[model samples]
Target: MGALQGRIAWVTGAGSGIGQAAAIALAREGATVVLTGRRKEPLQQTAATIKDDGGKAVVRPGDLMKASVVGRIATDIEKAFGRLDILVNNAGLNITERSWRQLKPEGIDLVIEGNLSSAFYCATAVLPMMRRQKGGVLIHTASMAGRVVSPLSGTAYTAAKHAVVAMSHSLNMEECVNGIRSCVVCPGEVATPILDKRPVPVSKEDRAKMVQSEDCGDLIRYVACLPPHVCINEVHITPTWNRGYVAALQQAHVGAGKK
Candidate 1:
């Protein structure tokens, strides 16, 4: 039997990228996965892929930016599964504005609402169920920008990611006694669709050198499968190439006028 043979896991932003990969990975481990995203078609695609692999999955499409929708999702999960063993707060987005001077109020709100507020709403919504079970795992997909500022990631994105890390730590401190574990993953750069949102376009060659979504999926699966007694508080994953450090330099020198 798989390590998560009877577990129930819900992954937000499960349509594409890291979220989809993580949901599939958990299902592969025998968890009944719940896939949630803004788009129904992509969520259905993820669910179908899981079913194709002989794993169980279902799709729940909604706008996570709304606290009410997030609450409804938790309630729906409770009604359908009666229990949730894992919650992956993986929904997030960034804007093309890299600096505060270039950032607009609407852009900041979009980043904050999509990245930070959504995570907060989802975590709060599920905490009661997790506490009642007296054992569960919460995984937040923060960014390397959380640990340090990156010119590539905009100010709003960086601020929101930093808050995610802080929130994860706070959850651990407050809820570890309740048998709840919270882990924040800080990845430098991954070949996900989010890269397309960057202010400066990344070359295919550069993207190839970055970490892949599956790599993060594997890491999250490893973290989730550990014994209940073990709590991985935070993890920092970066590709061997460490492009976040060099991306700025490359844009200035190599990518100039390259389109």
Candidate 2:
């Protein structure tokens, strides 16, 4: 049997990219994965993939930006699974604007809600169940932007991600005694659909050079499989090629030419 056999894992943003890949990975390890996302069709697709691979998965579609919906999702999982072994807070988004001057108030709110507030709601909702069970893992899919600013990710996204990392640390500090572990994963320039939202569009070649969703999925699986006594508080992963630096240099050269 796989390491996570009989565990119940809930993955947010399971429709595509890292979230979908993580869901599949957890299921392969024998977890009964509950896939949550804003859209039902994509969530269904993820579930189908898991089933095809002889893994179990269920779709739970809802807008996580709403605290009420996040709460309902947690309650639903409890009713179905009796306990949740893992919660992957992977849902996130960014507006196309990178500069603060270009960022509208609405966009800022959207980014905060999508990337930070939703995670907060989900974590809180699952805390009670995890506490009662005496153990659970909470993994947040933060970004490298959380550690350092990047023009590509935009200010709002960076701010939200930074907060996510901080939030994870706080959760760990408060709940480690309760047998709850929180980890923040900060990946650099992953070739996910969210890349399309970058202010500077990533080229196909560049995307190929960047980290892939499956890489992250595998990492998360490893994290989840660790011994109960071990807790990885934070992880930062980046592509070997360092595309962000290369892109910045290229832009600088172009600006020099224009000058």
Candidate 3:
């Protein structure tokens, strides 16, 4: 039997990228995965893949930014499964006009709502059930931007991601007493569809060197498989050939030539 044979896992943003990969990984471990995303078709596709692999999945698409929608989804999950064992709060977004110079009020609102508020809503929705069960796991897919300020990710995206990290740690502080664990995953330069939203295009070679969605998925599965008494507060993963480090090196070389 799989370690999570009787577990119920809810994966947000399961349409594609890390979320899709995470859902599949969890299901393979014998968990019944409930997939949620903004688009119904992608969620359906994810469910289909899981079903084809002899795993189980349910597709429930909705706008997670809305608290009412999140509440209803949580309520439905409780009715269908009685308890929620794991929550992958992985939904997030970044826009091309992310810098302060180009950022509009609307852009800030959109980024914050999608990256931070949506996660907040989902986490809040599932806490009650997790508390009742006396044990659960919440995994937030934050970014390296959450830990460091970078021009590549822009102001709004960085701010929202940082908030996500804070949110996860805060959850652990209060929820660990109830056997609930929160893990914030901070990954650097992942090659996902979100990369298309970058102000400057990332080279194919760079994308290849970056972390893949499946890598993050496997990480999430590892966290979920840990004993209930064990809690991994935070994890920071990055590609071996980190782009930020390379860029700094190249810049230093050019400055040395001019000196």
Candidate 4:
């Protein structure tokens, strides 16, 4: 449980939701956490909580959608920590179903670039450092929407998440040779501030029926605590009330048939 003690971890989207929770969890286990997100206040808030709990943390605020910033964050981590021990690519984004359907070129670019490409960019940036360090952990946060589309998220999100799945799998294969273990975490609907960014505000009662976010953080801790060679390729977590998102899909399919 305490395996992460004294380790250094970089977690994106750390301003809130799974990213925020997971960052604190990692810190509790002895990891010096680097919290990143577009908002400075929220990221610093997360860092403050960790520091209050006798944990180490720093904040790096930026729009991860920028490729240049991705590289810069990695460089900053290298400069600050000297050696990278863990990389948690936990940032993500989604749009309204209608917006996604409109296929605005910029939206397409943003979703793909932010949620998907950023992982590779950050991972690649850290790979050489990890290789030199002899061993490291790479954990990418993906959505269950990547596993299957749902009423909860839109096409842009699903597309971006699918790319994350593909990229993580490839990373697992490619980085193993360098003593780096890569894995993706596919979480079900989590009740966190990410819901606030949704086109619709998901109600607390409704979110409670979904996955408990602490569970997601625990899984990250589990992955981090595993023995060497025990790379859990992926984790699929969801609410008991939700099953394969069958209801949402059934309605979508039936509605399409009506059209």
Candidate 5:
């Protein structure tokens, strides 16, 4: 039997990338995964993959940015399963016009809603169920930009991610007593579709060297499977290549030669 056999897990943004990968991994471990996203088609695809692998999945499509939608989803899950064992709050987005000059008020709102507010809504919605059950796990997908300031991720995205990190930690501080553990995963340069929103075009070679979605899925699965007594507060992960570090070194060399 898989470690998570009989557990019920809900994964947001499960249509593609890290969210989709995490859902499949959790289901593989025997969890009945609930997949949610803005679109229905992608969530259906994820469910199909899990079903083919002999795992179970349910597609619950919604715009998580709206509290009403999140509330309804939570109610439905509680009614159907009576308990929630895990929540992967992985839905988020980045804007192409991320810099200060290009950042519009609307863009800021959209990024904040997608990355931070939605997570808050989901976490709160499940906390009651988890508390009643006396144990649960909340894994948040943050970014390295959440740990370190980065121009590449743009102002709004960076700020929103940093807030996500803080929010996850706050959950741990308060909810640990309830036997609920919250973990925030900070990963660098994942080669997901969101990369297409980058202001600068990323080369195929660079994408190949960056972290993959499956890597994160495995990490999340490990976190979820740990003993109930053990809680992973945070994790910082990066590709072995370390593209940001390499770029900084090359820029320093160019500046020295010009001087």
Candidate 6:
């Protein structure tokens, strides 16, 4: 149970959803977890719940879109724990208030800034320290939407997620030599507040197809628990219902090309 008895973990978006679940799971495995998000109450609540269960946790609420806060988060970790063993870049925001057409500038900024850039900032913040230590595990939450556009999510959300996938691949190639294990986790759907962050609520039928937050949370821990040499490059979680529509599209395109 204490596979990670001495590892230090930093989990963004821990106030809820996969981040929350991942934070608690890390603690369950014996890591001191730092929970970060925009709101303090939720972070505190998550920390409290973990502490109540005999897990060590801390909270650092900040706006990830701001580089300053991102730096602060890194500093906070350094101040509190000195070195980090695991990093879960699970914080993401989907701005569904307006369509891409309506939000050509503002919406683009919000989506890229919140989802993609935030992950970039956090990863960059930790890389130097991890490289110096000679080993660390970093997990970034992408999405099935990146695998293919979803009817339920916006274009910007999908683009930013795809960026995460690309970023992770690039980081894997860049940092593997330093004993850093990087992974991109693509989940189909989860019953998290992220759905509510949309302009409208997702239907019950769609929610049923979602992988639970706890499932993804445990998946994060599984990635974290892997042996130093065993690197899980990318883990994609999808409901059995997710037939490869993108594959079908490719097949159709080839058929058309022949015609």
lDDT of 4 by residue, 1-259 (tens): 4678878999998988888888988999999999999999999999999999999999988888777897898899989889888888988776554253566877777778889888778888888899998788888899887898755577777878988988888877887887788888988888876677677777878888888767887788778767767788888888887744667789999999999
Residue 203 local lDDT, model 2: 96
lDDT, residue 164, model 4: 90
Return the clash pairs for model 3, or none: none
For model 5, give the 10-residue run with minimal summed lDDT: 194-203
> What are the per-model numbers of colliding residue pairs?
0, 0, 0, 0, 0, 0
State TM-scores per candidate. 0.94, 0.95, 0.98, 0.89, 0.98, 0.90
lDDT, model 6: 0.88
| lDDT (Cα, tens digit) per residue for candidate 3, span 75-130 | 99999999999999999998999767888999999999999999999999999999
Query: Could you give candidate 6's per-residue lDDT for residues 97-167 as a string of tens digits?
Result: 55656567877888889899999999999988899899999999999877777645788888898889999
- The residue-level lDDT of candidate 2 at 122 comes to 96
Best by lDDT: 5
Per-residue lDDT of candidate 2, residues 149-179 (tens digit): 8676788888999999999999999999999
Instruction: Tell me how many residue pairs clash in candidate 1.
Output: 0
Q: Which prediction has more favorable lDDT, 3 or 6?
A: 3
Q: Which stretches of candidate 6 lie over 4 Å from their true place?
A: 241-259
Error of model 1, residue 230, in angstroms: 0.4
lDDT of 5 by residue, 1-259 (tens): 9999999999999999999999999999999999999999999999999999999999999999999999999999999999999999999998899889898899999999999999999999999999999999999999999999978898999999999999999999999999999999999989999999877888999999999999999999999999999999999989999988898899999999999
After superposing candidate 1 on the true structure, give the runs of residues whose Cα lies further than 4 Å from its correct spot.
Answer: 245-259
Q: lDDT, candidate 2, residue 71?
A: 94
lDDT winner between candidates 1 and 3: 3
In angstroms, the error of model 4 at 238 is 0.5
